[model samples]
Target: MSTPSQLSTNADLRILQRNMAAALMQPLTRHDGLQSRTQVDFITPNDRLSGFQRLEIYARQYWFRLLDCLYDDYPALRVLLGEMRFHKLCRDYLAAHPSTSWTLRNLGSQLSAFITEPKARDVARVEWAQTLAFDEPQKKTLHIDDLLGADPSALRLGLQPCVIALRIDHAVDHFITAMKKTDADVRSGASQAMSQAPTRAAIIKAPRLKKEVLHLVIHRHENTLYFKRLTREAFLMLTALRDGLTLADAVELALAEADPTTDWPVQIRDWFAEWSQLGWFCKPSPQP
Candidate 1:
């Protein structure tokens, strides 16, 4: 029960809203700024501001809000790249992968793949894994006593849902820990100096980071996330189990690549006991 003119006005408003949203998401540059102003018509200019200028305000704020979200999600990456470069990176990343989810937590979900630098990509991978581990569902954990009595050949094990294993070229874990410490120190200093006049404090240098092959296990326990360094053999065994191999087969595969002189049986038994106690294994399913 609408007139043709009213229906037409509604359609025009919808199109304008869509165009404005699209323009706001683009990079706020001179070229894009002019393009956006030309594409959308605005109300008559008042003494205070022009239509384009008003749109520019909203556009700039939108971009800055997205940049802040990326900064919060990847603080270490931001530190590594410095402020200006991090800002550019966030802009580029957002242009490529716009937010598709209702929640902003998934903003950096594709960051590791989007990053070009190898070291940055490695760090992003670790950070992403930590994010995933933090959100993974809680499950009943296996106990040491359960493994101690099971037959090695017949046993089938499952890793905890919160466990994530990564093999990387750089020792990113050490770098992340160092960066966190630096952040903590800076925050502490700021808190202490709030009442006093600002003074030049000695700058704390970040630890020298080096590239070295590393295998890591990221997992969650009691709502806290942790990173555990693993030996090559241990990584292989755990990966095998994660891939659905029987315990005996996984142990054999691990030993095949391990040092021949080492006492593998004792080593594996100790490793299993430690892992079991840490609740790295998933609880067995109830019998049908």
Candidate 2:
């Protein structure tokens, strides 16, 4: 029973809906789809409300939704930057890398990379690293005896599923600790006016180890990712061993860095046992 005019009105309104939906989900601008004025002004209802007035609702929501995604991904960064600076950073990020992602989680994948740009090249990597550090799911506690049956020198454990190696241009631990605070913008100590300043050594999830924290590597075995810190000697020894060097060759690699008078065989035996218990070695399948 509708007239031609009524049919035309329905068509125009449908087009408006299509245009608004596109604008909402992507980093589209007012002019990207239909002329903003056309969608805003050509309404079917003979009401006082203008078309632009109604479409403004969609426009505002678009910005709000995008900001929400960014907030979830970089809460620590937001805390450090404070409300005003953080919002500004978000705007800059949007301008540089519009909302092309369909899901919220992937929005921040480029954040650390984006920080390398002239606008944010400084705080980007470290901040992004802190947020993503917890993104990987952790495993359950594995008892030390879990690998007891395995021979000590035959297995080689690798990084856990929850661990990701990152090399932030900025020191990671300092950035995380600083952001973990309530204030966010308060820099660590008087020395940190700039990020390049001398900083604390790198350590992650250190508090969980329940002992003195220093440098070392982490890996998964028996449903848990265990950490084995290396002294310079330990790291050198392990690195040498990983390079296909024999036990003696590995010990020689570590000796120069160890206390000048340390015993070689004793250290190697202890290293072999500890490494074996940690699933750092596996037996060669007995000759067929």
| All candidates: TM-score | 0.77, 0.48
Q: Which candidate is the best by TM-score?
A: 1
CA displacement after TM-score superposition, residue 67 of candidate 2 (Å)? 1.4
| Model 2 lDDT-worst window of ten | 191-200
Q: Candidate 1 regions off by >4 Å?
A: 1-17, 30-38, 42-49, 148-154, 181-206, 283-288
Decoy 1 TM-score against native: 0.77
> What do the candidate models score in CA lDDT, each in turn?
0.72, 0.48
lDDT per residue, candidate 1, 134-194, as tens digits?
A: 7777578778777776787878788887899999888888887887622211111121212
lDDT of 2: 0.48
lDDT per residue as tens, model 2, 1-288:
112333358776676566555444444343333234344333444387455655554555556556656765565555445566666677567767765656555666677665544323334543443343334444342333554574535543332233333322333344434445322232222321221211222322222111222344444444433334456676666665555555456666678656767776676667656765554543222333
Model 1, residue 80: what's the lDDT?
68
Worst 10 residues of 1 by lDDT: 184-193
